[model samples]
Target: MVSVAYDGDEKTIVRRRFLISGIVQGVGFRPFVFRLACELGLSGWVRNIPAGVEMEVQGTAGALDAFQHAQAHDLPPLAVVTSSVVEDIPSIPERGFTILPSADGEKNIQVAPDSALCGDCLRELFDPADRRYRYPFITCTNCGPRYSIITAIPYDRPRTTMAGFPLCPDCQREYDDPLDRRFHAQPIACPACGPRLRLLDGAAEPVAERDDALTRAVELLRAGQILAVKGIGGYHLAVDACNPEAVRRLRERKKRDEKPFAVMAADLATARRLVVLENMEERLLTGPESPIVIARKAQNCPVSPLVAPANGWLGLMLPYAPIHHLLMRDHFQALVMTSGNVSDEPVAFEDNDALKRLSAIADYFLVHDRPIHIRSDDSVMRVFQGKPLFYRRARGYAPRAVRLPFKMPPLLAVGAELKGAVCLVQGEQAFLSQHIGDLQNSSTCDSFRHTIRHLSGILEITPQIVACDLHPDYLSSVHAAESGLPLTKVQHHHAHLAACMAENGLDGAVIGIIFDGTGLGTDGTIWGGEFLVGGYDGFRRAGNFLPVPLAGGDTAVREPWRMALAWLYRSLGKDAFDLDHPVARHLSDTEKGIFAAMLERGINAPLTSSCGRLFDAAAAVLDVRQAVSYDGQAAIELEALAEGAGVSGTYSFGIADGEPLVIDFTSLFTDLLADHAAGADTAAMAYRFHATVARAAVEACVRIAGQSGLDRVVLSGGVFQNRLLTEMVYTGLLDQGLQIFTHRLVPPNDGGIALGQAAIAGWQRGC
Candidate 1:
């Protein structure tokens, strides 16, 4: 057959020119168009224009139609084509598809942030003949320096940090080649031009050459020395986790106790020896983003006990940077890679700042010259089912926003206390902030403000309103006030429900069991273990655990016995305040009398329905733990001890006025006393208490579901991190034939608070 050419002299009508907006820059959009047009055998030219990307296609009717269809559904993974409008234009000569150099278009453009290095770049770094071989900052079109380098809109070399270093003649050639991956790659540079590294001792004087920084850092780490290494986002305090003394010293200097640290190993083979890896876990570990947390491990993994301590799992990430890769190549097996920060603050990034702030924690510094415009911590994740769930989103995973299942107006959300993160949503995309730490101290608050300003400047989004937690004490709420934007105070647990709904793509009303350590209650008290019934816009208090006294205020959280004392009063009245238990003997006679009087008089003792406190009470009852060395330690250890215990499944708590069955600790306490009297193992009782709580929670959920004509259950909040409780609740609900949705894209903890706040804001704005 003769080659059919509609643009030939036989017939030529008109071609349409189009402009695409919204996340159409720096995400391989132009390259995608080039490939698509070529595959469809269409004649077209696509290139980056200032505000967005522009394209002109000329072909037969079928070819043009096919291109349009593919454009709608077959876009790149990170591409968000918000609007694609076609305008009729004059026909030109038809030829092969081409990708042209970016031109100045009138529309405002936003470039994507830097990504982790790609596989091709890694291969080039190891190839001896390559000019970029062993270069620590090798980057290609697909990855490296985007968000951090770009100074303004229209992402090109002239407007980025790379502007300081002009490309060499050979690199310029690669930039001119349309078929090459490095073509139009803004951050691309050779060994002759990229950022340099240097090793410094504790005194801040040079200790090694630029090329020897990695080798020297490894040597120091192998010798059980702590090194502050500058990473793509921020500084990380690295040490050999296998050395318990080194880890303990680092922890002591950083003043971070019990909170598990993350680890980085050489490769997947090394990682597998430390933690169990499922199919999805393996993919996440080795994928381009290569985050540091996924796949729960055994508590006793041999590679590094200090990495997780008493915790069952350690967060792990592969080397995504050239420097990181080089460090893992020799000397050390695996290193503890925790954020380089003091307690209650963001990690330090700048060299001068690291030297001053990390002087006590890091024995040496592995410094680099590239300036970090924005600081991002490592993204943390966990595998649920076959998908990775985000705990902390930053580094390789952010700036590239998530598209909402529903469109939303521009809004900014100041997330809740603890594991704080921020969110900004415009149209279908939502940009989540890096892990902002807790909104308590001035340093964290300052970091949160700076990050917000930086991100807002890049996106050029002015929020119509600010959404925040209802808790008045949260620094996030105060910051929202300072922003001068109209504020929406979303209830804490409602946001939790909405987060679950948003992650699961659910819009309808359902029963949401929001069980966490704490949240400000609507009734002017502390509430956790709440059951809410509603969707994104609003929620109803369906049911909640019965309120009990919280003795000594926050002190009860540190000493489980105080909560146990409160439980004893609730379950057995004043007559049951026994001073003969194991916990009682530890308290002074005068202290015991003071606690008894305080509970009886309700002096500064607030009421709480927190399941976390209940767990503490259980811990005290079984003598598993009487006092916590860290926040949630008692409960965490209790769950850890419950491993391998047989489940009987028959357990009950007293029903109070047809509400959620109040788990009477007095009865549990009495049972424990009897068990002790009968010489029953405390381990078995601890396991039984966990199983009983699971059973009671399920029963309450089932009863509520039947009454409310709702079947779907949403499990949320920090308490769900207890793996045993999670597995039991999941298995029981599934067996009952009820569809259940839990956090998978985000965590069940407060780390997910930002997304939830975003969803509610969107729903309220009717976006």
Candidate 2:
């Protein structure tokens, strides 16, 4: 029988089968389709099949058209429909719209990154008349956990950690009712059936439960106590940001020094008082991702100085978790929301493990009975020219598939050291894991392996190839060497170059100026600042920074003075010590003799073409910093010093001709010393140095382009993370009539290297 519908006397019958994919499951897509079908007065059915959401509608052609339009345009907030396949079908006899049970098939569905607490859920949470009032585990179709709670594919409740808790009658009605907002909301539960909340003392024993626990937590925070609070992804050690002693106590206890900690404000209005926000920053803060947005601090901000000492910017985010919302409802303006770990270790998520690891650091523990299947730290980002620049991609961003420009075989890329992450690819979609900390110790290395298995298990990908960095000493590289899959080694700078290309969706080669601290060059020396021309297939070195000695190897990184001495020796030979420079004055005659010998004979010192070392040298020479607590601290301080200096002049340098042209800064360094001798303003000199690097970068690109016939330029690597340097180089390139591209989807740092490695491996394998 043919189903027919009358639209104002125009009787028509048609049928179409639609296949929708990409973040379409676990996001109320079925419920949305049900409502849309009923609205258009059509008869149809939708269900979750492993290949994604599938539906067939039979109705008047006009009504079907309206259904299609609404389905494409009006979508639920968290749902993302990536691809749709439509086909003509014979008319079917159907009475009304319905949502059918999920059927088994080949698993190929994308899980949405965890979302922030939605407004509707928030309203029900706080309403006195609501059944789930003040429920910390309150959630609806629009918001709450997704990736972090899933245990397997198709994203059904039985495949999640929530399977243990069966639904109550009231919640089951909401779950089954087609008209209800939470229809098919897998994690929906009222207080009677949901995860239990409690407050534990220092020894991990419960002191209070339910509402009393929340009140006790609020009281502890008001008394300037640190609380280890379990969140969607993992645990966070939280304290009042306005309490100076509390912030300091956290820093001292956590063994974290100068790296700024992210703070969670009660709301956007409170965030405005903490930092200066533009439209883009504000939107990102309140967006579904709910990342910590780095922004310029307001004048005399009330946040404790210890929160971000010497930093003009602060990382601020609004409450994302429901417990966070309830805790900050009326008690505090802001709270320190740093990750739950010591300075070097990975964030702990398991209940007992967190208790053992963070018990000393946290005065009390606010926990719940729900199990977090995967631990993801809060994502962090900064706005660059009205675009989001990620520092860490996790929680709300990880595990979301990024489509490739072309199809490729399945591959797994173990990312580089320092800011570790991994990329898994199946055909055209790439799934990147959350930030996995530096792969320096067994703890983080375990986390690295665990992340790979977790992502692979959930996505059902059997990788044909494994990719890693060229440097063999890295734990990621070592792991790749042992993996049973075929291996591909990717050069560090080449990976950086290819990462920018893949991110911008460019096929051909462009000029790549890659700058960072240290990467293994093909010639067995340390390479960092490099200029290359090529695409994903291959690359040729086009230019490089002048080689300089790295005195004392790793020690030169922590103490800028050693790198400064090396730069001075390279520029002026042994006579550099006789000068009246601060760096020269730091060493006595005997020390100078020993260091000069080290530089001359290359004793325990390796040569490097690193722009990162140059930043440290410049900082030390300018007396801006003597030693750094972190890797990029010197450059960050230099950028801060140069900002608003109100000076505009660049130090000129020369480009020495060679097979790979070398950018020589001897003249620039000499002139900088000349200015330092005159006791000039340090800020002005700092600005000139930044301008000099920018100008040199532009000139070098022009020279490379003149010879290589490439007009497009991509600036990449860790050094470009500097807002000052990146803006200057990008603007300078734009003025040269060149197409410029930079990192947007992934970070410019090593965190994004795995994606590049995966792309390059795909081409090498002839994908």
Q: Which candidate is the best by lDDT?
A: 2
lDDT of candidate 2 over 682-734, digit per residue (tens):
98999999999888888899989989999999878989889998899999999
Model 1, span 609-703: residue lDDT tens: 89899899878867878887667788888887776566554334654535443534446666665666677776677788777777767777777
Error of 1 at 188 (Å): 2.1
What is the Cα-based lDDT of residue 259 in candidate 2? 82
List the candidate 1 regions with Cα displacement exceeding 4 Å.
1-24, 35-41, 49-52, 59-92, 100-114, 296-300, 573-580, 658-666, 765-767
lDDT against the true structure, each candidate: 0.78, 0.89
Q: Model 2: runs farther than 4 Å from truth?
A: 1-11, 104-106
Q: Please give the RMSD of candidate 1 to the true structure.
A: 4.0
TM-score of 1: 0.90
Note the residue pairs that clash in candidate 1.
51-107, 113-147, 114-146, 114-147, 407-767
Best by TM-score: 2
